[model samples]
Target: MTLETEFRTRAFEDVRRALLERREIALLDVREEDPHARSHPLFAANLPLSKLELEVPLRLPRRSVPIVVLDDGEGLAQRAALRFTELGYTDVALLAGGVRGWAAAGGELFQDVNAPSKAFGELVESERHTPALDAQEVQALLASDANMVVFDARRFDEYQTMNIPGSISVPGAELVLRAQQLAPDPTTHIIVNCAGRTRSIIGTQSLINAGVPNPVTALRNGTIGWTLAGLELAHGSTRRFSPATDGAVRVAAAAAARAVADRAEVGRTTRDEARRWADEAVRTIYRFDVRTPHEYESSHVPGFRSAPGGQLVQETDMFAPVRGARVILADSDGVRANMTASWLAQMNVEVYVIDGLTPADFTEEGVAPPARNAVTPPASDEISPAELSALLQSPGTVVLDFTASANYVKQHIPGAWWTLRAQLADALPKLPPAQRYVVTCWTSALARFAAPELAELTGKPVQVLTGGTSAWLAAGLPLETGETQLASPRIDRYRRPYEGTDNAREAMNAYLEWEYGLVAQLSRDGTHGFHVI
Candidate 1:
């Protein structure tokens, strides 16, 4: 069929005008989900190439609606324009320079639908807009009788593991929905924090975006900054839940998480109880403070490692490989620890949450807890961290850090490579099975879950960082910190040259387009979940 709609090669001016004039222009991103989740134009509605026929009809309810198409540095836009034209879209046009041009024009790009880049940008911009306090500053403010309501804008898991003393988990995405859950008085001064900067910025601004009638500010650089400033971090020894809420519910949830761990009967661990497991050299019990990366990076349990909540759920086997070995969880917040514990229980694995215990508390209380279940199985076939490390010293040991790109860029353990969590399951097959694989993160929680799974999936001796990166630093091991982000086709295209092999450029472009739209495609995976941190 001949193309009916003429292509507008110089449509930048038109797009700028349409945006300013409030004219409805469907700025369609033809890029796939992964890259789109990584970053995208602020106002763009993603219309991926594969889903063009399906999404176009749903998004563009009006037949004659103006739409623009984009692909990552490819000529797919022209093909898409022809397709749209063939599909009866008269006003369809290709965006000049596509998303690249929008970015070049200094338009804000969003990361995920709950955009962290926008939130981080607004937060950087907000330093001048709001009155922020660091952990020390907040302490001083409290000492000076400043009435501030502290909200932890991390996942409930991180909050329960260790938060800024009094902070509560009111995550950024839930800020708009759960604002009223806090603040009986709207006039109270509000301060928010996550492990580091991103979520706090977004969470604090979410309040402002929703026009909440409270003076909100983020803890400067969040809890990492809080710890670097020589502040005290709190952990609960026993979870404090609402008296009205049944403890059995938590037990039921813990049972679920144990199931994830592949255990039949689950048991609880007290501070002393957990220490007994920690003391056993043969056992190799990995303690994960299932909190956000920022929080885990800042300060966590001395022996405990960071394992983000959602990722822990998805990749439980990787982190805790003693298939049915004991895995203990600690969170500063009750809800997240309980929630993750529940998932672990469902996995049929042994799990427990550390409640109200600081490092001092652990030292004060010896290892012991009231007896419960005695179904401790035989020694797991799981390889220890020391074994994995020995393997790494050999040739081809691929260490993947499945954490946020920004966090991965900031500081990671020495010799670890960056891999996005969304792409972790997909990236596994690419590595040669002969190579030893070590999947790690800032802390043990993610590694605790991911490492074992990697071992299981790749059948390579996969080991988690026993105490995560913090342990590495404490042991005086070197760390790699820099602005140098891991090179990917999506991040650094110049590094990957196009050899004229079977349309390499076209294939790469198509792959990136698909990557940009990956999360949306994952929704089609029927997983009934989204990435939580």
Candidate 2:
């Protein structure tokens, strides 16, 4: 039977009703990231078809959970449904007419990633009356030698890109744990900011919730507000919170975070409990290490992925795509995990923190590898960088790079066409016909995963560039810059207005204006199950 006949289909209103009823539905946009970012339903998670097999286990652990996949009428939803069936997904359906159908049905389409969380943050500010200071007020404070510190509650990379002149990089989850150390004086005021609203509001409230003695406030609408006010942002600043030397400070921070977690009713679990959760066949469980990347890289619990506490709170949907999944957070320092778990609980996740696990138990190094069965492309389908270089010298071989667009623009193999794995069906017919095709990305995982698909699509001999571009560079091969050979448009990644040193003022203003309208959109959509506590 055809895929359309094999799987059920859900209309936009059916999906909308499921969301409003708080049912466990994974409304997925099975398109490439760029297209998914351009427009989607508020709760629709972007689980690109290319990464479906690898991510589905983690993101949707319950095999029987209802899944409604959609694309912008690119024939992806049908293919995704078939793949879902193959992967043992018991309840799979396609969104009727895809994303266009949702729009046609009067569903509000939101741009950018994590719209639900961002909108929820805006709602929190409106409902909770989160305190704030406008850019001018913050600027005047910066001018004086005020006994206050501004914490940039964004990722370190984001903070380093652009920030308030004197702000230190303390991500949202870290605010509760590190705020006391950053501002020991009870009378000192604390200011928090992010590229936009969510992190700033969440971070400020986190500090307030933890009962930090210092008065806390979000820096209005964050760096966007600062820039809109014609204020300057410092670039490439490295001011981050220093490690606490005082044992007493660590103890106090942990106590404060625990108190907040208790109030939030976040549960405490043991390693034994985690093992049991992992074994449960009917439920989804996410194991995360809520510490700094460096710390997580140095030593982390086995089977626990690294998701720093602050970024976890800011991007919960990305981490735990399954809304009702159980998340167990781990941290060598108890404070970060508890603080992060508190927010996750408020966000309506069933979250827990692993307690009584020692550093010895966290003996694993670097990020945890994907599960063994996630990707194991056949050995015969792989070619080394040197082999690929030799093959490229021949005429009928086409190279398709599947790395992110930003990485592709930075550097790639000469004469390589950057393509999205999910868009290969649409992209292949436009490409020059070739007898042999090579697939690659930064690492070979995505390339390997796409090899069979590319081969099937073109009816040609396709091989993965073993170890990908990184391996090619290590092999001393020449590299090319810019968007050189393109079989596809650079729509695989969204260009964030707050990124880099240079961004158009108009885009920044428009982005802020869009964020401001999100609360109203939430009301209109009537699907987000967000509650401000």
Candidate 3:
């Protein structure tokens, strides 16, 4: 068959059947974040076409995994499928009728990012009826000397942003690994919390699953509930769980985690077995070192990409788009990988924890560059940071910042208009006419991709900032802040109602109610291959 005939459109019903059968398939939304968040299928992963090469190889692994690319009639799916073909992806198809097509075929469309995992978390909570304490009870406990400790099961940076007054930073996977150090006294009362309910529920359930001897409970609705109760939150708190120093405690924790993993039917595999799996041409295997970023960058087994265990569990759909692909998790400490694998297994993933790992086995050093099918070198029209600074003062020059709107709000070169790479076609008409254009992003990696497009769109000379906005900061150059001067709409991220302190009370409650109904939604949708362990 000709290439045109081979690139067929997959029906939404057929895709649903694959999901129900627990077969390997990747449903990708080839659009920017904002547009994708507006509508998509339950299992569709947003893999923006602009960053396809930069992210796809690690995410999709085996080239032969069946992939259905979808778009909202922007003609992006056809272009993305062709790009996938160029990247040597053997089986690529387009979703017929795009987002509208799915709806036309009676497929349920979900709003927001990470919808599948969020829905799964809701399902887990509903089935298990995970024990939890409401805000009032938690407040009363805090008022008294109840011997209770609240652990924030979110990233440290998020904890730093805002948290319950006395909660300590102990992110999800670390809860099991650091339990011995944080709460050696079995009688101590433990409360797990997150920005919302999901991580906290998972963290509390993780402890319960491991058979920890403590009385544990999730803080109902997490910090959102706390905020709704007229309680104050502490900002810039640095309290964190220290590493386990006692060998006895570490050994005990590891043993507990292993037994829990065993109960969940998570397999164990040796290095030789892992290597053999990686070499298989037909099966997709995702090798991930599920440890802290610092630990993975310092040392890890080669060929394993860094994916912190907690985030990996919460963002599995993002990391491994193929539903039934084999996932191999490695970490020197037995607690992290095992605990993480148990959750994946319960989520109907084929997961395994590396067996018999040691410090000596971590031979690789530093972060691995993302796997890319193509890389265009810095072309003739690149300018140094100093050169960009000089050019910014000239009348004919206009700088377009192609980074995320959040980053642009945080810090960006003065006079650089916040721009979106994917929206450049629409944005060009909005931007002021100029004789020269300089494009930039975080590392100029994305900026290089934008440079050629911007040049072609405007038919103007476009120079890329040698190393993007980061290099400008390093040079001690002057910068500005806030959401000013946008050439493109800031549709890169959907702001969550639970985030930040300024959300309206009604919005927060609405978000909670939405989460509460996810289990019912899951039942109606009927494609999630999830079960309680």
Candidate 4:
């Protein structure tokens, strides 16, 4: 039988039924982020074909979990299915006819990452009557200098990019733990905001859920709404949460956070219990250190990856792609993990906090284990910057840059084609015939991974740029800007309309409208097992 016949194919309706029935399934969109963002089913997780092997074991460790791979009629689904089988996944199938088939079956296609979670955030606002204040009201509050503080509940980088005039960066999961420090007065009015509605609503509700003394409200629709109202936003703001210097404050915050977790019925697990969960062959378990990146990098539990508690909850789908997997969160202080686990428990994740672990347990550290199928480049197949420069001067040498789209646009080797590593198979045949190929990325890590694949596919000697584009710059090589030669369309990264100041007002308005319509779409999709507690 052919490859298509070798794998079972599920229709969109079958997937829909599986979702509504709450069956254990992962409907993965196996395309790059850009195209996946342009359109996809509500619950479809974006698992780019390029990062499949690296992400699969961490995200979907249960080999027998029923997985349906999808693509946009690009023959990616079948290829991904084959890869899944090769990775020892026993129950992999293709989403028949890909995303096009889903649309044809009258399914709604969302246009962003983490659509389900965002949509669920909207539902929570609708159901729980989450309090919020629009731009004009918030702007007035800012002007009056009332007893209030604005907390931007987004990543620090995003907060730095743009924020309300006086807002301090307090990301989602940190809102409860740090709120008292930012606003100690019980009667103080607290305003939470994100780039858009999801984080703001979730952050505001997180405070309310924890029963903070302050009266909290989300800045309606976040910065998007603020911008649309013609309000000015400050850029390059460096304001962040101050450390709690007082022992009483830390003790009180921990007690309050733990109380919230207990009320939510969040489970607690020991390191031994976590290890047992990881050893289970039938279930997928994720171990994460829920602390700041700096703390995590300084020292952390061996085999545990760093995922700040706030971002983990905000982007849970990205962190834990598999729907039914068990997540074990670790934090040295214990409060952050418990608070984060409380939210995850409400979001229908089987979550636990690693309790009673000492500082030494965390200090006995190591880096995260490499992916099961991580590639090691052969030194024979690598070329130094000087060697690549000389080769570029010669004819019949083609360079393909596999860096992020944004980075590729910033600077690259003059004649290098910006290519998506995942689309190499489709892109190779379209490239001009060349005797040799040299692959490079921001660093040579991804380049090394792709070199062997390119060599096997083209039956040509492929060499990796020793240190990638960074090394080229270090060697004082002339760089070029803008897309030069392109072997593939730049569909590897999605440009967020809500991000940065360059987006059109129309796009921002449309993005808001899309978010507003998500609740209705969720009703139609009927697969998301979201329950607001």
Compared with the true structure, the alpha-carbon lDDT of candidate 1 equals 0.54
lDDT of model 2 at position 519: 91
**Residue 67, model 4, lDDT:** 95
- By TM-score, the better pick of 1 and 3 is 3
Assess each prediction's global lDDT (C-alpha) against the native: 0.54, 0.84, 0.86, 0.83
How close is every model to the real structure, measured as TM-score?
Answer: 0.36, 0.92, 0.95, 0.92
Poorly placed runs, candidate 1 (over 4 Å): 1-10, 33-42, 45-63, 79-90, 99-128, 138-149, 153-166, 171-189, 194-216, 223-533
Per-residue CA lDDT of model 2 for 1-533, tens digit only, reads 45556677899878877766656778888887778888998878889887777677667767888889888888888888898887778899989888889989999999888887888788888888999999999999989988889999998998999999989999776777677777889999999999888899989988887788899989997898898899999999999987553678778888888888888889999998897888875667788998889888999888888898888877777887765568899987778999888877877678899989886898789877876335355454788998888888978989999888889989999999988787788788777779899889998777877888887777889888878899999999999999787777877667787664375677788788888898999888877666656
lDDT tens digits, residue span 304-401, model 4:
88898878877788888777677899987756888888778877777888888887887644456675535344454788999989988878999999
Better of 3 and 4 by lDDT: 3
Model 3: lDDT of residue 299: 92
Best by TM-score: 3
Please write out the lDDT profile of model 1 over residues 131-203, one tens digit for every residue: 4577787878766777677887666666776777766666543344345446546778888876655566545
Q: Write the per-residue lDDT of candidate 3 for residues 1-533, one digit (tens) a residue.
A: 32354478899989999888878899999898878987899889999887776678778878889999999998788878987887788889999999999999988888777888788888888888899998889999999979889999888998999999889999898898887678879999999999888898999999998888999999999989998998888999999987545788778888999998999899999887898898875778898998888888899998798888888888888888888789999988798899999999988899998898778889999997656434444464899999988877778899999888999999999989888777788888877779999988888888887888788888999998888999999999999999888987777777777665365688789888878888887888888878888
